[model samples]
Target: MPSTSQIRNDRTAVAAWTLSVSHPLMTLLVALWLLLFANLPFWRTVWQGVEGWDNGNPLFLLSLPLFALCWLYLLLSLLAWGRLTKPVLGAVLLVSAAASYFMHSYGIVIDYSMLTNVLQTDSGEAMELFSGRLVGWLLAVGVLPVLLLSRLQAPRRRWSRELRVKLVSMLLALACLVGIAMSQYQSYASLLRNHREVRLLLTPSNLLAAVHGYVRRELRAPQALQVIGGDAHRIAHVGAAIKPRLTILLVGETARAANFSLNGYARQTNPQLAKAGVISFSHVSSCGTATAVSVPCMFLEVGHDHYDESMARNREGLLDVLQRAGVKVLWRDNNSGCKGACDRVPSEDVSHLNVAALCGDGECHDEVLLSGLQDYLDRLTDDAVVVLHMKGSHGPAYFKRYPAAFARFAPVCRSSELDQCSTEAIVNAYDNSLVYTDHVLAQTVELLKRNGQRFDTAMLYVSDHGESLGEGGIYLHGLPYAMAPEEQTHIPMLLWLSPGMERHANLQAHCLEGLEDRALSHDNLFHSVLGLMAVQTAVYQPERDLFRQCLAPRQAFEGRAGASGAIN
Candidate 1:
């Protein structure tokens, strides 16, 4: 026979346990835990996510960790203060909601709309932001607890056994969570192997680079833009252009050409591009898995082989060569910076995922770039080179970025939540995004065609890197270099040049000639761009150049170079 107080305490514990279990709190907490934990390995990802990471965003870092503990504090309050009054809890909920809304809606560069923009899948930034698809969780974890505690009429309930059981369950859950986390940590290297793009956004090394770049703020052009080694203006003298101001290089973000319909992914993802008569390269490969490396590597003098070795020392590159050769260079980017490629030239970050573009709506669309593109074209100088970096296919929250209009395809062939949705649903969602990318390319080409009278126009489109949507259990890019897949390394490359434009540059002959659709890698970009622009720079690497008749044999099976571009 237990004493009266002990019996009361046991009953009390049981009652408390029931409240926790029955309420949506436990489940909501679990969801949040999984969401956060799945991403915990990359601290900055979730860190940069919550709006407080940036100095501009002005969210107190301490406040976030403190706010995270609020639920526990609230539970304690319930235990001590008994049931909170309806009006009081309601006000508290309202205030919290308002604050959350304000924080989420304002001053943040990312949101859920990009995820919804699946129809326009080429918008990679949307995909990255969309990876946060913890929907319904907001209501359950956020509003329900407050509502229930305040609304329930009873002041007391016996919860002894229930409490003990609940505590044990939570502990087990935490243990399982720990086990899972540990497994992820153990598999971290392997996981990164498949998701090679992780180096781009998450690695400490990358963070160090970003921090250093920020400290240096080296968008400062290290060299002056002057005509280099030639008549600079005449394309024919250098040997490619019949007229100046005709070439366009649209660098896509996070687009894996393999995923594009152009590469035979079984989805009509590239329908619009196909309809627009765009020439899709079947076996084009990106040199590096990350924009940080790939973008610069493609534009650098030393290719990926010596990029890391000599990037810091060697200052001159394609843009420098082009600028010195007198072609105008303007970068219209939606991703981060031009990663130092535009150091000497001009650049604009046109990310629609920015706070100003998506105020309160929480639905930043990738098409926003398209809206402002006309103005960009109009601003182009006669002999100008423009680079449009679209946010293509970046993601984890694959479903929320696209609007209802772009959702033409169905069954979502695959889902972002991996196991929750069918593989088809996930693929469908991803393909839908690819579809949007096709549209973007089409629109871009049309603009060039429409502006043919103003200048001879050509568009070169290539993705920064590829993506992994539930392939090998990964739903995003950022795979480690050592274990990146053919799917991840292989990407779509397209050249949409007007017949006149191609002929002017004398590249029309090779337009469809040698692009036999085999393996051509980003290593070829350095020289090809020079050939396209006819920029007469000594720094151009002719051996790796795509224009080389021998290399263009179309029988190239694989990129001879490895991740760092060694023979390995």
Candidate 2:
């Protein structure tokens, strides 16, 4: 009943609606906005770098449009493939929002190492990173854009036509980007050269680069285990009784040297350790800034500069060398697994130990590592080395690490949401865990002293990495090693040697005390352990050994020993 003109207009309106539903342009715009909003920190930093620009210059004005076009070209090229557009946008929105919040909040950058650290982290440690701010940003910046993207639809076309369109569009974008770069060659070069980290700070690009690197490393066929320390044997001390030697290597977790009283901390976090005659080594640096890297590296002969995590995983470490040289090696872990360090060694995970007094909800206190200690010791037929991997000061749940009795620091941060708590409360909670570590280490020393009559005994405690207690707006660890703050790398190393063990090796504690303030690191751990247990090996470098000053090397060379051999 309508006029022809009105009917034609109605059809036109319907066609536009169909185009809106089927076309990807709307989704592309939403994606572009989401990317910019989510990565505001990156833009803010870039602006700060260029804030003192020549505002009146025509070139500067031109740069703005060029910069905008650069991002547009990138986004169009990324989203050109039709079916992946919405899902890819959703993923980008979520990941970029999360990365932006953490990168801005903690002043961090994403690279392969940081990505690996995230992938290797335990659930408990990861939980500490969650907060209300994270949830708010995710919902506001991530979810909203994702919802909008989902509601929109892509236009259906022939497969060949779609592929051709995608190829042409991407090639056009590439050409435009190249033209812009050529026009502003000097400016682009200067910006990138001066601010190399800017590349790592890009939102979804950084994430993609990191993921690609991780996947490449993971997908590579694992290399064969390169054998080292082939000429390893235990050297017999002249005219000494054939008593068993027992050394406890206590691998502490996340306890920084800055909090230890013996290391000159204002608080007496190491009250028990101060009285236990343990040599607290200050100025000790870690091999890496996280457990996944530090734990295995500490057990290898490799130094921090030459350390490769994949190599460490494939090869045998100091424990294997000790076990090869007639020493009984046992690893008791209270934290996560030994991270492949004890894969071939006899290892026991004590997380499930049901001592309610020291454990709750499947998490056991460090002292639980001491449970059934004597019984485990009795099973060893020869000189032994046992590693006690402690769950010390691991954060967000610092209060959960220790029992109530050791909660000496008052008004602790009880909640896992650390950013919501006061700095004092967080420190108090973290310090309480340190006090508890001191107790556990002291108890370990006592256990060794009790067994001193049966076997010459000693103990060495070294943390895998340090923790950051709201310092520089950083909480928890695992910033890249090069950019890591001192709090994450400066760890505490303590040594307690019984008189019998001291006499057995002719080593002096005073000599070790003198080296306390000397700069040392996880590199010292491997060779030092080899020296401590008298495990003679070709891999042993006396120059790298911390105890080299205390004991003389073997007077004569000896043949190599296998896993089943014993020194007489």
Instruction: Estimate every model's Cα lDDT from 0 to 1.
Output: 0.55, 0.80
* Model 2 ranges with Cα > 4 A deviation: 1-27, 47-76, 130-133, 158-165, 168-172, 179-195, 552-568
TM-score of 1: 0.56
TM-score of each: 0.56, 0.88
C-alpha lDDT of residue 28 in model 1: 37
Could you tell me which 10 consecutive residues in candidate 2 have the lowest summed lDDT?
555-564
Query: Against the true structure, whose TM-score is highest?
Result: 2
Q: How far is candidate 2 from the true structure (C-alpha RMSD, Å)?
A: 4.9
Clash list (residue pairs), candidate 2: 22-155
Clashes of 2: 1
The lDDT of model 1 is: 0.55
lDDT of 2 by residue, 167-240 (tens): 67557656777777778777767667766667777677788889889898888798888666877777765544
